[model samples]
Every structure is written in C-alpha cells, then in structure tokens.
Target: MPLSSRLPILLACVVALGGCAGHPKGVMSPVAVSNKTGGSKVDMLVVTSRVPSDDPATLFTGERSPHPYLTDISVSIPSDSKRKAGTVQWPKKLPPNPDTDFAVTRVQQLKSVDQGRTWFRAHVVGGHALVFVHGFNNRYEDSVFRFAQIIHDSGAKVTPILFTWPSRASLFDYNYDKESTNYSRVAFEQTLRTLANDPNVKDITVMAHSMGTWLAMESLRQMAIRDGRVAPKIDNVILASPDIDVDVFARQWTEMGEKRPKFTIFVSQDDRALAASRFISGDVQRLGAINPADEPYRSKLEQAGITVIDLTKVKGGDSLNHGKFAESPQIVQLIGQRLVTGQTLTDSNVSLGQGVTAVIAGGV
Candidate 1:
C-alpha cells in the first residue's frame, strides 16, 4: 500500500534469496578427475566480467573486471539413476564425492581469444551452441553449478557457453546487481558478437533468466542497432522469469527491428521475486509476470510472433515459484530438445509435448 509497507515486503522477498552465504565459498576449486568415477560430467566455457577473487577457490567476485575473463570448468554430477531433474545437488561437504555430489572435476583458464576460438572449433558440432546468462543474487560458483545441472538434465547437444556477470549475490544489493548488468552490457555484447562472427557457430540460442534478461535484451537491442539486425545466427532467444519492465521491453523489442530472433518467454504470475522487483521499480509489471493470454499483451505478443508459456499452475521445487523453468524436468527438457537444439516448432494445442500440458498461451 504505502512506501513503508512496501519496503518490508520487498526486504522479505530479498530474504527468500538468502542461503548463498550458507554454502562453502570457492566451490569452483577443481577436484581430481578419475576414469573410474561413476557420475557424469559437464564442461562449460565461462566468460565473465567479474573481478578475479583474491581467493583462488572463489575465482571471481561481484566487483567489475576491466576485461572479459575466460575459464573452462568441468562439473561432476550425482550418479543416481533416479536423480531429480532441474536441480543442482550441491555438495554437503568439501572434496565432494563424484557419485553423490555436484563437484568441480577440472578447471582451466583460456589464455586468449585464440584459445577460445580453438575451443569453439573443437566443441561446436554442426555449429550449434547455447549461451546462458545467470541472473541477480548469483556468485560465480552458483551460476556454474546451476548451468552444469541444466546442461546435464536438459541433454541439449550443443557447445555450452556460460556468460556470468558480476553480482554481489546479496539480495540487499538488488539495485547494484541491476547496475552491474548495465555496466557489463558491452562485454556481453562482445560475447554475442564473437559467437556470431565464428564460422564454426552456425546457430546460437541465447538464454537469460531473471534480471539477466534485462542485460540480454539490452545487448540484443544494441546489437540490432549496431549491425542493422540481430545476428541471423542467433536464432532463438529464451527469457525465463525475466525481471524486465514491460514498457522497457516493448522499447527493446521495437529497437530490435522487424527481422529479430524468435522470442520465447516463461512466466508465472506467482513469482514473488518479480513481485519485489515490481515494487522496487514503482509497480510497473515485469515482463516475466504477465499473462500472455489476456489484455494488451495477448494481441501485441501475437502480432510480434513472440511465444509465451505461462507456468502459473506448474508445481516447482522453488518455494517462491520463481524458478520453474530451471526446476521443472518437463519444461527444461522441452527447451533442450525443441528450442535450444534448433527444432522446427509450431504453435499448436500440444505445446512443448513433454507431459507439460499447461500451455495456456502462445508457443513456437
């Protein structure tokens, strides 16, 4: 109601994002990889703009870095055949077991862009790649572990590239996190440009979650403005639980011009994290919290040929209902098989045929 009333509620939502400090720091420290290890592994090329941490274990901090930092990290997943999909099983103890925990199996620092290009040549099969952007309140290791889980569970057959930005990982630093995205826009744009320019990269899927969507959209908008269009290689843009202001997103979409990438958004009205974001931004509706089936959104989104999947009734492991995209097995795999892997999809009644039947609105 009043500003005083809203502040406490916003702070409470911020508190739901706690527990980052509870985990051990520097979980990125590489562990010995053994041929005898039973669990699976996911290796990612991480490009970050966060200042390198003084502690080697942590690798990067929330503060900004002058240059883009690159690393290749391998993560070991739990061996259980019945392991829950869309969840990162963080190690309860250090030097985690490959059979029972998510652990770092290998870590390497790429010396230069040439070295990264070499990676692209070696890894990108048939020119398919996935670029992931982590959201606010995430540390370096948090994004790593989560992206690893996604790649593992989604089973997307593509070169995995993670673009992690500087985030204090403190919910109280929400405004600072938002600004960090703005500051790192150029670096992120550079990342997209590099991938687009690579001959080995024929197709790219850019996926952004939470406030990272703001950064991703801005980068795309800038790219479209600079290059006369969003890169043709960047075919699909997935925004999940995006924390973008609706009006701002409309401007971004307009700036991207007519020949833009196909957009798919995952939204839920029950997203408490976005509710806090709404209050902090003067109650403007966030794009990820809209109902695509109703009102001005329905006609506008349909006219733009944008797809929106509403996950309001989709039960998620997240208490806040803010992470259904990453927390639900059906939805994540649907992303991998159909959208990220470059499948030809159409809007139909059986939207994303992964046993997830709650396709309330538009789809691709």
Candidate 2:
C-alpha cells in the first residue's frame, strides 16, 4: 500500500491499542530515574485512558481545546558507565497515583544549575519569576530543558518555571493535544496564583508558545475576571507564535478586564508551521504569526499597549519556526536586558545586528 493509504491503518492501530487500556483511576505518580554519574536523567510518565478514541486527536487539531497533554513521556541522560558520552535510559514504568482523580506524568530530572551544562535544581534566589508554557507536541523534558537553556543563556535573574501539560506527542493527534491544553488551564492558573502570591516573587512574567498561548490567556482572563482587575500582580505577558484565532484573542483580551500583563507578542510572517496552522483553521489569521510589515494587527496590538516583535528577517535554527526563542541571541538578549528590566525597546534602540530596519511601534 502507498504510504498515504497506509497512514490511516497505522493511526487506527495506535488508537485501538491506546483505547484498550482503561482510564487511570487517579493522578499519575512521579517516576524518578537516577544516573550513576550523579548527573541528571530525563524521564516521562503518562496517565491516559487505555482506550484511544478520535476525541484526543480531534481536540488537538480543531482548537476545541487550546492546551494538550503528552499522555506519555520519556526522559534520558548519559549512563554512568559512559561518563564521556552515552544515551540516557529508563528502567521501569511509573504507576499512576490511585488517590488523585487526574492522570499525571513526570518527565525527567533537570540537574543543570549553570544553565544547560548539567541538570541541577538550584536554589531559586530573589528577583521576579518567569513562567513558560510550551505548545503542542512538546514533551515535559523538551519544554523544561529548552527554557532552562534560554534562561541560562539570557542571564536573567528571574526564576524560570515551566508548566507542562499532557501532549499526545504525535502530529496526527492535534485536536487531542488541544483538548489536553484546555484541560490543563486550571492547573496553570493555580500555578500563577501560587507564584503571584509569593512574597519573594517581585513580579510575574509569563511567556507562552503556540497553542499554549490560548491557555495562558484564558487563565489570565479568568483570574482577572474573578478579581475584577486586569493587571493582576503580573508584569509581562509574552506570546511567541501564538496559535490562536485573531478575533478570539481580541475578545479574550477584552474579557480579561484589568489584570492583563504588560503584553508583548512576537510575530513572524515566514513561519511555515503557522502557515500550516492557518490552513488547518481555514485560513483564519493568527495574531502571533502576522507579519508586522504588512499585517494591520501589528498596529492594532501596539495601540492596545501590546508590543509586537517581527522576527521574519531574523534567521536561526529550527526549520519549523519552533526554536526562535533560543536561536536568536540578539532577540534573547533584548528580552532579558529590556523587558525583564521593565523597559520596552523603542524603535531606535531595537537593532537586529544588521542594517535591517528596527522594529518600530506603529511604524514610528
């Protein structure tokens, strides 16, 4: 059979096998794996219904839910025997907790304190806290490690916290992943409230990627509505390549009331992934993927007190337009040096290291 024809068969098989397992009774337990070198290993635990249905897949792709969970996860690190270099491994499957009513998964141990050199849970000192929400198809370890690298590379004093939802970790399960993202909203909000209430936490900055942006916005909107304030103790809200309907974002922003973040949105016209997203959504434009050079949404966002960064001309790694957060050193530096410092980069100060035009708010 042709690969195209065989694809459905493979998907059916996966769904059948997944559905065979019964729903877990409670929250999944954390699975811990240790490396002999006393370094760190990454692992993932997933609590999901054994019976796979089209529901999860539908939720991810259809935008039925903005957040999704990776029902399964894996973590790896170098083995002790090969100190110089070897692959990480997991010995056993972590069971789900019978007490809690939700499925859970723990990905891995990040032991790198000096950035991404090695994984270590360093003591979080002072300064504000920056929370990151990863988008669809990301495993827990992937999100944590990437953000760790970004934080380390930026040399920002803020403590970084990652909110990992359950993602199916498959391209086909887009709707399922989106459903998971929606399901994780409450947990995300709880995390925000916890950090915001922390006396040591000076301010809160939330940076969400792709579909996670919906979850982030919804959580903030809910919080603001409940509190009747738009600027709820938070400082910055950065949305990177948000996979949301432009109209929906506008409505959400309006409903968020007073507790809005000092908003910053990053956009790129050449993001192929977003192009695919646009196609999947029937060509409805997304604010995060709009080109500031041409899209009027740039001016609209600026008028609404949201700063938009156009990275279409900026080149870097990750062909899928996924790694822009960590790829552009200049962008990262600007984010750390200015936004984190409670300052916005004006057009004159915004330089991309070339003769290219700087990012001007409202085109100056």
Please give the distance, in angstroms, between residue 306's alpha carbon in candidate 2 and its true position after superposition: 1.1
For 1-364, candidate 1 gives per-residue lDDT tens digits of 7876777777876676533345556787878766666778887899999998877678899999889988988888876573688888776678666776788878888989989999889777678889999998899999999998888888898899999999998877888999999999999999999999988999999999999999999999999999899999999999999999999999999999988887888999888889888987888999999878788988888677777788887886766778889988888887888878655445463364433433333334
Q: Highest lDDT: which candidate?
A: 1
RMSD of each: 2.3, 10.5
**lDDT of candidate 2 over 1-364, digit per residue (tens):** 5655755665564444334323321112343433333433322222121122344212122222342233332323333343221111222233422121111224332222223111112324464677778887655434544564456446667666666667765667767777777777776776678666655567878888988898899888877887786445688888888899898999999998744567777887767667656666657998767766665765675567677787777673555665465567777776676776667667777776733343545421
The worst-scoring run of ten residues by lDDT in candidate 2 lies at: 96-105
Q: Which candidate tops TM-score?
A: 1
TM-score of candidate 2 relative to the true fold: 0.67
- Candidate 2's C-alpha runs over 4 A off are 1-122, 354-364
RMSD of 1: 2.3
